[model samples]
Target: MHERQDVRTILNRTTNTVASIRFHLILVAILAFPLISGCQNLKPLPDGLSLQGGEFPSSEVAFIADTSWIDENGQRQVEQALFDDLFRIIDKAQEVIVLDMFLYNDFQGPVPETTRPLAGELTNALIDKKKQQPDMLIVVITDPVNELYGGLQSPYFEQLEQAGIRVVVTDLRKLHDSNAVYSFFWRLLFKPFGNSAANTLPNPIGAGCVSIRSYLELLNFKANHRKVLIADHGSTYVGFVSSANPHDGSSAHRNAAIRFTGEAVADLLQSENAVLELSGHAPVEIDIPRDHVNATTSVQVVTEGKIEDVVLAEINRAAVGDKLDLMMFYLSDREVIAALKQAHERGAKLRLLLDPNKDAFGREKNGIPNRPVAHELTAAGIPIRWCSSMGEQCHSKMLLAQDDTGRNVIVTGSANFTRRNLDDYNLETDVVVRGHHSDSVFVAAHEYFEESWKNTDDRIYSLPYERYEDRSFWRRRLYRFMEWSGISTF
Candidate 1:
């Protein structure tokens, strides 16, 4: 009996040692993976050829001159040529396609031909391509908040997955604003049952393949807010960092996308893969080399958590510069507001287009009145425009800056000039494009700004601000009850 006891103790010790070794191995692996994959080295532009134009150079890189147009009715159309060029590049994708959008939904239009959603058509095209080439790779990454509020669901994503394409939904937690009590209750009640008790709600995408990790990630503080598309391993499209979602509500919003070929696509793919890793998705294969292409035009790749303040700095730079054109769905950042005021004081010509709404995400914050920033700007003698669409909100974040000699700059992306967007609880990206070629693009964008400005009502805040107290007592009570119960997280 004594001998048997000794043998059992030895066996237990060996098992514990093996377990410890395995744990350490996993820890090391996790620590090393990000470091190995995160390094990226961009190459410098070659000599004798500047991003500015001398001749329409034919060497792999091509510059699409930006131009603005004024329609017969004086509607400003800036960057029309740039958008046309971008679409042309998308039309040329020959192989694998990947897209990540924050918001997307199918919308029925007045005409059957125009009824298809932008994402739906794009998905169908990818599906057809997958059928043709069995080995084709396709991917999509989207934000959960946009999916829920924008009326987008997983069936569409699952359909693409069934066709053997990769679809990843980034669980951006900050955007959801999950109530603390609700999350705690879910963790306590549902975690041990391993059943659909509370937190383990039904996966919108169907079946056993539902991602628990995604839902959990959404409860975190950081989020992946990028909206991008890559095709044929070469071409890429990046949506403007704005409130615009791929849904009917945001369809009418004025938005912009930048298209690029050559090495920039690879850079974008790497950035997306980083987000996927953070979301606990399997590591995506990195296809582009560290120093793959010499990017002639200046480009900056911004990420969440870090470098957020840098984005604000750029906005400030533009606002305080000689001339600034700003378009945004929401603008409540105190720093940005102060910067704009200072810029105006500095004799800068500032034009702002603000959405006449409470919040771009359709929520109230800090009991503040949901008035358009245009009112404040216009009162200060700055040209402020209120953009309105037939059925959708104006959802674009773009800034155009110019100096006396047409040295133009353009800043575009998903980052809103708001406290939540700038300080915490959102993911955003913005890029500054410089050089003469970009100047032309800026001019074109300026034209569009002017046209939209003309269409805006000068007195947007003249009407009395609606209050929640106007609702029926029962309705108000129900809303307050939901807020208290933590049901508002849904």
Candidate 2:
């Protein structure tokens, strides 16, 4: 009995030692993975995009939610002028039509809006274009999230495929996994087991249809969150970079886009084609006409890791008398926060129009990282405002900095200023536009922020920062930890 007791104690000690070593090893891996992945060089865009020109004519458009303003006596209203602008471009396409939208389904979830049938309108437009110009190259590139990451089949994709359009579903595995807490085990243990062959559960997006495998795949928090539309109309090409998603539920959201016509359009197209190539699709031919517009402004299409690099560079360059205007859905990225602080110290007039970080699909959000981050920024004397929104989010990811020397730079696109959105984890696209206020596009972008900020014309799009400020230390730490860990929806 004495011998047996000694043996049991020895075994218990050995088990504890093994457990400790395993825990330490996991901690080391978690710490090193992001650094290792981030250190590597970003993959290059497809060779097809080499024809992009640098100078182009560009215009800006916006959708302001003017419903909740006190000046409006009767009912609230949302000015959704973006879709019509999109339609104008689609109607004028003569040769090639390339669209890479992140959300293109009919899943509105809890607070469904009477959104225009944007999906059908876009589909019919594409189908009509294909019918009219059979030889015209119509390519539709989209993320796999439309099909809930392959748990369900998207009839929208099927329809486009049937219409003979080159539909390329981005292979998400090609991009970095932002939520790697479970991705390691998922890729090894579960992915091998495979997924359900048929749709088996209710769709989480409220489509009344989903599968177990869909939920399983969704646990991998990564996506191609870029929203761009490129139309090459023979001698001229126009591209739009914006936060607006054609998804019905997103129609009510306050969003913005820049309609640029020139060599930059081809560059945007090039970025999309690169995704197609890396996603294992065959190369499609893109015609490049020698096109350069007479304009003082220049535009560049930054994709993948370059988007983060360019945006940070713009922020870091801010100086005294320069104005930094930011309006975003989420802003939990430490790097950006640090940059903004540095810019503020340098005497740059800073204005932040932030989403309250509350409300999602009719569900109340505690304003996780944004509110806490806002509290930190607001304490530092940076004037902030909470976007007055109903069901839709103030989903625009935009930043503008103008120097006293009449130099202005605008950075806007689908990427939120969050770790997951900006850390080269999820695929993103942002256009960096440079010009003076004299440029119409530049003027429109400047006016959009100021109007929304000051509530011009009695349109209440935002409120003071004190309304949703949260200064709890624990919440701030929680947000920072989540962001650092890369476990975030933004």
Candidate 3:
């Protein structure tokens, strides 16, 4: 009996040792996967990006916005011109139309009121254009979230595909990992299983159910968050970069865009070709006939990490007597926050209009990074205001800086001021417009901002910073943790 007991003990010890070895093997694989898979060494960025193009006439660049506000009777009203311009550009397309939008689905949960059918409209617009010009090269590039990471079919994407439009879903795996700790396990374990169109679990974003793999992929927190439109119009090419998406849930959100036609469009196309190349799509070669102008304004295409570089350089250059106005949906990038403070300290007048981080479709959210960051900025004597969002968000991402000499610089596009968006983890695109303050684009941008800042025409566009002041110590720490950890979406 003693010998039998000793044999049993030895067998149990061997079993425990095997389990320990297996655990360590997994740990080592997780630690080494990012390097072996080249996940951290992301695909090379497009070469032509961040290059300043030859100056075009200020008339060629237009500032468009979609504004939502409340009246004295507390009624929500929306005035939109951005999409109208976008559709008009689409109608004028004759040869090629390339649209790369982040969110292109109409996925709204149970909501009380009817939202604009932006997804259907955009789909119909593209389909109709395809039917009108059967030979037109219409390409639609979007993210996988619209399809729930292949856990479901996007009706809009199907319609676009049926209409002979080449829809390219961006390969998110080619991008750097935003949530590294979570992504390592996901790549090693879950990613190989691949997502299915089977619906076994309830969808987190909208109605209906989706596979669990969808949720697993969502934990990565990375995306191709670019909203760009390029099409040939008349004799030249036109391009648009905006913060707007054609998703119905975001239809009423305030957004901004810049539309231009010039040498800049070539740079924009080149940058987009890089996306195609990285995503395994054939690169498009379009020979844009550049036209000469009086060099009234300089427009440049800046994407991904280049956006951060340009924005920081502009903010750091803000000296005394310069005025900087920023309207952003998210503001949690530590470097940007510190730069703003330094700019203010150098006597640069700064006015910040930020979304209150309160609404997500029909859901209510606790004000996070925005609220805490606002608290920090207000303490530095920099004035801040909260967009009085009733249910929709103030989703504009723009910065307008004007020097005392009437030189103006406006940077606007799909990027939010968050670590995930600015740090090269997620894909993004933005344009920098350098011109005189009197330029039409600058004037329109200033008027758009002033209308909201001053609450012109009895429209309550924004509330004072005190409306959503977050003074809780714990919440502030939580905000920093989430930002650093990339655990929460900004």
Listed in order, each prediction's TM-score against the native is: 0.62, 0.87, 0.95
Quick one: ranking by lDDT, best first? 3, 2, 1
Clashes of 3: 0
Expressed as tens digits, the lDDT of each residue in 211-261 for candidate 1 is 354355334333345556656534333322223345433333456544444
- For candidate 3, write residues 1-490 as lDDT tens digits: 9999999999999999999999999889967876644545465544433333443453489999999899988989999999999999999999999999999988885563355889899999999999999999999988999999999899888888999999999888867777877887788789999998776899988878999899999999988899999999898899999999999889999999999988888878887887787788997777986676676787888887778989999999999999999999999999999999999999999999999998888888889989999999999999999998788899999999999899999999999999998877777899999989998999999999998787866699999999999998998999999999888886
Global local distance difference test of model 1: 0.49
Best by TM-score: 3
Where does candidate 1 clash, by residue pair? 76-451, 78-444, 78-448, 79-444, 103-246, 104-246, 173-218, 241-413, 241-414, 242-414
Q: List the lowest-lDDT window of 10 residues for candidate 3.
A: 46-55
Error of 3 at 49 (Å): 7.3
Residue 351 Cα positional deviation in candidate 2, in Å, after optimal superposition:
0.5
| Candidate 2 residue spans exceeding 4 A from truth | 1-75, 197-200, 290-293, 456-458
